[model samples]
Target: MKRLLSALLATAVLAGASLTARAETVDITMAAGHPPVFRWVKHANQTFIPAVNKALEGSGITVNWSEQYGGSIAKVGGVLEAVEEGLAEVGLVSSLFEAAKLAPQNVTYFTPFVSSNATAISELMDRLHEENAELRKSWEENNLEYLGAAIGIDDYLLMTTFPVNSLDDLKGKKIGAPGPAVNWLKGTGAIGVSGNLTTYYNEISTGVYDGVIVFATAAVPGKLYEVAPYVTKVGFGAQYAGGIAANKEWFDAQPEALQNALRRGGVAQREAYHKDLDQAITASLEAIRANGGTVTEVSPEFRMKWAAGMENVAKAWAAQLDGEGKPGSSVLSAYMDAMRKDGATPVRDWDKE
Candidate 1:
């Protein structure tokens, strides 16, 4: 009877321990304004989520992800607010739309014709955020925490109904550009209309504009080539558009292991996203050619001339942010310095000018 009682008690203790070691299941709602068709959103769903899951194996923590995308929960300009309000725990917060709050992240947009290597640009921005507290401040101040993966756009190009062999071709033409990209047309003799990817196709087809400043990755998917058969590789440069981020309060409350796992996922996502992007850009350009679309690469002289003709929007942007006590000037200098250090020869040194 004594031995039986001891065995029974030991069994009960083991059962309690097993229950205590049971995995904790966390439900995390990940969101994005764009659909999974977009590379960034696709990688978030495919790469990031799986990386997190793999990292958490046998760690006594698991996540049940609730994915809301394609404006189901938040529109293009609303992801940041959604995460801030706790409507979603994590989101692909597009810095392009949140330029007012995330001014420094949009530094690449102001300094175009720099580098078209999306991977290098995205990794550089991630390194900057890791090393520079000033860049991270914008994310924190907005009640969010930026994860490592930077959603980068491929090189911006010119798509139009007519061929653009020279700057003279764009003279007096209506060109649609998104957000700060509109400034890219300054002194080019083209009228820049503020536009976006979602409406570019219909707007161009309906004669809302004759041309648009867009990227190849998006141009193929959006099928803008059908209407704008002439594609020009202007090399406006890859842009750091946004990143995967979590609500600050929620992220802060997570266990260190779980937090680290999410970060690992972000890093993995960045690699996968860029790999797919490189392939996509190639495939997109091929598709454009096969579909009767004309692709043109301007001469180096033409490119340089185009770059010189643009107004110094970077200086203006940096000055405005500096006036607001943000590290605008520093960010511009740091970004340009880093790009130069990485062997990128900008047609115009934005910070120096």
Candidate 2:
């Protein structure tokens, strides 16, 4: 009896040790510049957080999430610094704003008229980052671990108070475009004002600009149609806006289980985000029409002419990166090549030019 009691006590102690070893709870903070109303931010909450939690199940690890969005923790173009400085453990870092730091990630923006499939662009970009050391280095240099969940914007549209049947219609017009995208207006005789979604509606409403280069998924929510009622589907091609990333230092210190969960969450989030975006694009256009906005699509010939007439921005962008000792030309070429390989016939081969 004494021997049996001693054995039972030893077994109890071992079980306690096992439980202690497996028990872990990690606290993480996720942030974004945009509010949860935005698709990217919405996915972070609905898709990413839940996916991470699901991945962590049965690992004896649970995550406590603190979400800070809508410029609560950081404003636009500041999310990278916020994560890097450890203000937030994770962030939706907008490469659109970090053009200088994340130059390589802006390949899609420079080469328009290639493809407008947001899901494909997101998948391609995520794969490129995984395959290219130079691309990965950009994030690493910024003290970030670039996860998946590439934030892709759908085909760009021109929203204006006036109609745009041809480039002539835009002459002398003050058009607002997001970063890097402003270059898209070059040679069109239109004045380009650098702006973002947060400012586009107000800017257009007050005559700060006549119209904006925006996407449908975002336009509906922004109620931009109310301000600029004409929507022209210019098909400037989908853009890889930004991505979800973690503070490298913080991420590196996490246990393997937690790290894997984060990565898996990123994958799930990317899939979910594009899925949501596809639906939103269709719904947004319908919403725009329902709310008294005019929707028009440019003729394919006009689209081709518009693309062809633009200055070789891709070449200049690549050259600028090359001067900076980054793989600008290679990335540009690789991106175009990948698009072509995937059966996309670009209106203009920006790289080849």
Candidate 3:
């Protein structure tokens, strides 16, 4: 029995030694074009990374995270290609920036004035992708595996150097909007110059553009009110234009445990993002006010007029998608129906006509 006890002690020592040694670690590189200032990247920093790390503890699995952000790996519009090309193993691909490639995934952006609750809009997107075959197909075709909703920003507002009391106030003004958002200005008579958050201040300050179609969450962080102090809350609807994605080939090769960890981390990131964003909206607006910026809301009458005046871009966009051999109308219908089911009353029924 003494010999048997000695052998058992030896085995125990070997197991302890194995435990003391560092576990095999998987290295994942997460990239985003935008800096951490934007909630898109901020959640990645605050939630995604830490959640995965904590979840994998003591599981014989560890991840070495290389965070490339603020244009470190790719520019704002280039994140999709970077992930596709394997430069980034995982990333937040900007659907808004890659609007042309992800056109069918942009149902909300097309149907503006839908709902102002950003979190609700994001949750609906999560449900659609899970329920719709074509939606999943669209992301698969891009060679990225969708992790979870990486919703960002908040309800869009009009920030201009001049106050806007009426639709006529926007006439002939060169306003900056990003990607597909340029269509939001149609029939409003605003010259929708393609622009993004990074340059809103400089562009508006230097007279390159009179104003920007921006979200309060970002406009305040960007200190846009300093340049364009007139903020008109038009409720152009909240948007979900990007999501956490993994390089398909790489993700498929990962162990199922790692894949699940990444997906769970993404979900945690989304929840933390909305919580952070909701709080930031009020705090940021207060800051904007303290900085001498004026905040005004467009009357319900004005909202109706704006919605009516704008051409039926949703249907037009759906037609364009159909021409491209996609189920744009179906996606539009699904999106609007989901919103209505959630008790949201949109000013215009984008899918009706």
TM-score of each: 0.93, 0.93, 0.92
**Which order, best to worst by lDDT?**
2, 1, 3
Name the candidate that leads on TM-score. 2
Ranking by TM-score: 2, 1, 3
RMSD of 3: 4.9
Any runs in candidate 2 off by more than 4 Å, and if so which?
1-23
Instruction: Determine the C-alpha RMSD for candidate 2 after optimal superposition of all C-alphas.
Output: 4.1
**Per-candidate count of clashing residue pairs (backbone under 3 Å):** 0, 0, 0
Q: What is the C-alpha lDDT of each candidate?
A: 0.92, 0.92, 0.87
Model 3, TM vs. native: 0.92
Output the TM-score of candidate 2. 0.93
RMSD of each: 4.2, 4.1, 4.9
Backbone clashes in model 3, listed as residue pairs: none
Which candidate would rank higher by TM-score, 1 or 3?
1
lDDT of 1: 0.92
Model 3 lDDT at residue 219 = 89
Score candidate 2 by lDDT.
0.92
